[model samples]
Structure formats: structure tokens, C-alpha cells
Target chain A: MDLLERFAKGDDAAFEALFRQFEREVYGWILRIVRDPAAAEDLTVETFWRIYKARARFDPQAPFGAWARRIATNLAIDHLRCRRSEQELPEQLGAPGAPNPALQREAREQIQRAFRRLPAKLQAAATLAFIEEKSYDEISDALGVSIGAVRLRMFRAVRILRKEFNRMGLKP
Target chain B: MTKLENHDDVRAILKKGFPRIRAADEEPRRDLWPAMLRKLDAHALRQRVPWYDWALLGALAGTLAFFPTSILLFMYHL
Candidate 1:
């Protein structure tokens, strides 16, 4: 049987192997979405816990990475939604320059600010498309939306981000 | 400009700006294995059924007792 099947049968070793394989990727993906290292860790653990609990329903034929990513993405999106009331966008972007660590961090923060301004679904779509570099089909599966919807969300997200960046006097 | 023209402008800007955002591949700041293990252990413990579920069960039992013939009908449908 496959790893998922073994896990479904309560094989602890199989579960451990799966966790070790996907832990970093899952955690990174969550961190990108939530922009909180602490919350990302908690959500990563919760994703794995969910996977373990729902192992019996897992289709062995499906790609494990995609399935795990979908779970993590959904959890991250839900977390973002819950914390929506408290989120704030930074007012300015640093001037453009050669790639330095400080410049990179500033750009990242600005991107995050622009990102936070989007609706949760739009954020998910844009993140999957731009940050995760996922294809439309992959993003559709991850976000549980049609490809058309994903495209629309991406479009809207970009539009909003551009407008916000313009207001901040940042040439996007 | 038309909406389509605005959309094109936004797309152009996004193409330029997106790459400026850093790609993160960092490990979690702290180890999470112990916490996860604790969560797993907690999950292994028996879960308490909610009061509403218990009430629903009692109602079903009472209904079955009052109309035992319904059991035969349910079995037939199954």
C-alpha cells in the first residue's frame, strides 16, 4: 500500500515520514500566506493533524504535496479572515535600489501590505499564482475554485495592489 | 482610459513589482515536533460528545421505542 494508505491504517512511521518530507514546504507556504512565523508553525502542525485525522478519506492516487498544500492554504486563508479586523497596510514603499537584504525586506513588507488589502480569496489566488508560482489549474485545486474564478481573483488582486502602490508613490 | 486599459496597466505593474518581493524558504523559528506530539496525544484521548448529540440520541431512542415498526421500515429502505 501507499504511504497514505499506510497512514490511514494507523502506521505511525508512515505518518512521520510524510511529515518530515513536507514539513518545511508546508511551513514556508503557510508563513508566506499569514506573514507570521509563530502562527505559521501552529497552522503547519494543525494541517498535519488534520491530514492524519482525515487519512481515511485521502485518495492514494492524488499527489500528496498538492493535497497537503491545499490543506495548509485553506487553514492560512481562514486565519487571515479571522484576523482581518486587525490587519494594517504600511503607508509607503522604500525607494528602488539594487537587491540588498534591507531593500528585500522592505519590498517584502510593502508587498505584504498590498497583499493584505485584498479580499481573502483574492489574496489566496494571488499568493498561489505569484508567490508560490503555481499554475492556474494547481491554484484552482488549492483554492477550491474554478480556473476562471482564480483568474478573476488574480486580476482583481493585481488591480488593487497596483492602485495601492500608486497611492504610496511607489512605481510598481 | 477604459477598464481594459486600466487592467493592462495593473498587469504591467504587477509583472514589475512581484519579483521584488522576497521568496521565503526559511525553517520555522522554533522546533514544533514536541507540540505536535502533545496534540497527537491529546487527540488520542476519547472525545466528549456534545450535549445536543446526546439529546438527539435520546430523542431517537425514545421515538424508536414508541414506534418500533419504523425500524423495520428503515432497514427496508437501507
Candidate 2:
């Protein structure tokens, strides 16, 4: 039988093999959404654990990478939902090639604060669409939504963020 | 002004506000198999029934054995 089929039947070796193959992709995807390496690592492990447990429901014929990404996205969204709105994002996540480090850092902090205030779903959509520059199709696939839904989410996210930034009087 | 107005301005603000961090695209530093194993082991440990629960089950079974009529009550409660 194939690796997915074996995994579905509770084959430890097959599970480990799949984990070895997909761990990086899964972890990288989660890291992009959560933007915290440590938390991403933990969530990566959690994602695989969930995959293994829910193997019975998996269809062997389906593409594993997309399935794994979907699970990773859900876990990242959950992490976002659970995070305190006021908690500062990790300082290590500095903007690339900022002309002024101090001012850029302050701007990034304010933006992140506003970004985090968004509903978790909108945050995920906006992150994937604009920040990461992922395609609407890929974002929709990962988010388990239609392309139209992704567009709507992006619109809502931008609108809310604009309102929040205007209120904060912090123009980026 | 309405929420939908200034659409391009707000989109630009968001993009500028949240620039992509360089690290987001990189793969994890270390192999995560061992961590996955540890999480699996922890979940397994948690799934085991404690002695108190077994003792409670035994007491219920023993009581049911003494008074079979109570089986109906137990089923009803369940």
C-alpha cells in the first residue's frame, strides 16, 4: 500500500517517513502565518500529531501537502485567536531594509498591534494575501475558503486596519 | 467618509505597515521528529485511565451485581 494508506492504518514507519518529508513545508507555512519561530515549531509538531490522529479520515488519493497546509493554517489561526491583543510581537521580526531602524521599529510595532486586533480569520487572509504576497488561490486553499471569500476577507481586513490606523494617527 | 472610501490609501498603509520579515520564509532550524514523538507520548500518557476511575467502575459493577434491578437505574441515568 502507499505511504498515506499505511499511515491511515496506523503504520508508525509510514507516519515518520511522511513527517520527515513534510516537516519543513509544514513548519515554514506555520511560521509565515504565526510569525514566531518558537511557536511555529511547537505548532508544527502539533499539526503532525493531529494529522496522525486524524489519519483515518484522510483520503489517500488526496494531495498530502495541501492537506498538511490546511491543518497548519488552522492551528496558526487558533494560536492567533488565543494570543492577547496587547502582547507585543517578537522584536526580531524587523521590517526588511528599513531606512531608519528606530522609527521603522516603532511603526512596525504600531502596525502589528493594529493587525493583531483584527479577527483571526481576517488577519490570516491579509497576512497571506498582502504581507506574504501569496496568491488568492493558495491562500484560499490553505484557509479552506473560496477565492471570493478570500477577497472579501482581504477587503474587510484592509478596511478595518485603515480605520484603526486612522484612529491611532499612525500613518505608515 | 465611508469605510469603503480611501481603499487604495488603506491598502498601501497595511502593506507598508506590515512588511514581510525575512525569517518567515526560512525552514525550521532543527528536525522536529523527536518533538513530535514527545507530544505523542504525552498524549498517550494522558489517555490512560487513572486508578480512581477504575476503582469507581469496579464499585459500580459490584453494586450492579448485588442489585441487578439497579442496572435499569444506571442505564436510565446514563
Leading candidate by lDDT: 2
State the lDDT of candidate 1 residue by residue for B3-67, as single tens digits.
Answer: 23445544444444454225544588777777788888877653456668878989988988999
Docking class of 1: incorrect
Query: What are the DockQ scores of the candidates, in order?
Result: 0.18, 0.30
Candidate 2 lDDT over residue span A1-172, tens digit each:
9999999888889999999999988888888888888999999999999998899999999999999999999999999999839653433333423688886767767677879889999989888877777888899999999988888888888878767766666554
**lDDT by residue for model 1 over A1-172, one digit each (tens)?**
8887787777989988899889988898787677677889999999999998888888877888889989998999999887654456567666544377787567656655566667887877776666546678877887777888787887788768777878765663
TM-score of chain A of each: 0.79, 0.89
TM-score of 1: 0.69
Alpha-carbon shift of residue B76 in model 2 (angstroms): 41
Off by over 4 Å in 1: A85-111, B1-24, B47-78
Categorize the docking of model 2: acceptable
Distance from true location, Cα of A7 in model 2, Å: 1.1
Pairs with steric clashes in candidate 2: none
